[model samples]
Target: AVLKATGAKGVAEPAAVLAAGGGRLLVKKMKWKNVTVAIAEISNPLSVSPNEPAL
Candidate 1:
């Protein structure tokens, strides 16, 4: 259910997961979309940080 919501196939390999270091979740796209979505849960609940800063 969670995977479907996020559109991820499955958890990344052990090494890849370690490399991420809890920084972000990598999502693999199925279609030809030229975009990637990384998901992660933040620890600081009160902090409101934008996913991407203005360019």
Candidate 2:
């Protein structure tokens, strides 16, 4: 798998969400050329948004 070959975890579509801390999928997998992408909304975001400013 990708993680095994690249030593990078969660580079694949199926594992993307889980890698992002098990959130809902905002965007499904899309493929183009030699790339695959997915977007996930983390259940617990670790950082405050830039617009919100840190407290």
Candidate 3:
């Protein structure tokens, strides 16, 4: 749905974690007006490949 609307592959919050490496979400997406926020805890930075996409 977000991808269809914005052309982004994924949402910002979870994607941030995946971008860093990969992790578990500590706080799910929270929204207010046009603002959105989320928190994630990276589990193992070395496990995720740098060449991989965040999806």
Candidate 4:
């Protein structure tokens, strides 16, 4: 299980989690838009070119 490291509201938020190595994840304790969010991992943002297929 994961959790917040602290409870004190700094009246400001921390740095972006994704930039901080959150691995592209997001959780909504309360629904702001009442919508679900899905996350997927990218093994490689760059794909092999059709002309240069991998062996």
TM-score of each: 0.26, 0.55, 0.49, 0.22
lDDT of each: 0.42, 0.71, 0.72, 0.35
Superposition-based RMSD of candidate 4 using all C-alpha atoms, in angstroms: 10.1
User: Residue 13 of candidate 1: its Cα lDDT?
Assistant: 38
Candidate 4 has its poorest 10 consecutive residues by lDDT at 9-18
TM-score of 3: 0.49
Off by over 4 Å in 1: 1-32, 47-55
In candidate 2, which residue pairs get closer than 3 Å at backbone N, Cα or C atoms, i.e. clash? Answer: none
**Candidates by lDDT, descending order:** 3, 2, 1, 4
Clashing pairs in 3: none
Q: Candidate 2 — which residues are off by over 4 angstroms? A: 1-11, 46-55
Comparing 2 with 3 on TM-score, the higher-scoring candidate is: 2
Residues 1-55 of candidate 1: C-alpha lDDT, one tens digit per residue: 4378766654443324344444343543232355333444333334544775422
Better-scoring candidate (lDDT), 1 or 4: 1
* Residues forming the 10-long window of minimal summed lDDT in candidate 1: 36-45
Instruction: Tell me the tens digit of each residue's lDDT in model 3 across 1-55.
Output: 6789988865968665675456788787887888777778767856768999644
**Per-residue CA lDDT of candidate 2, range 1-55, in tens?**
5678888765655566786677788888777887888988776776547587422
Which regions of candidate 4 deviate over 4 angstroms? 1-31, 48-55
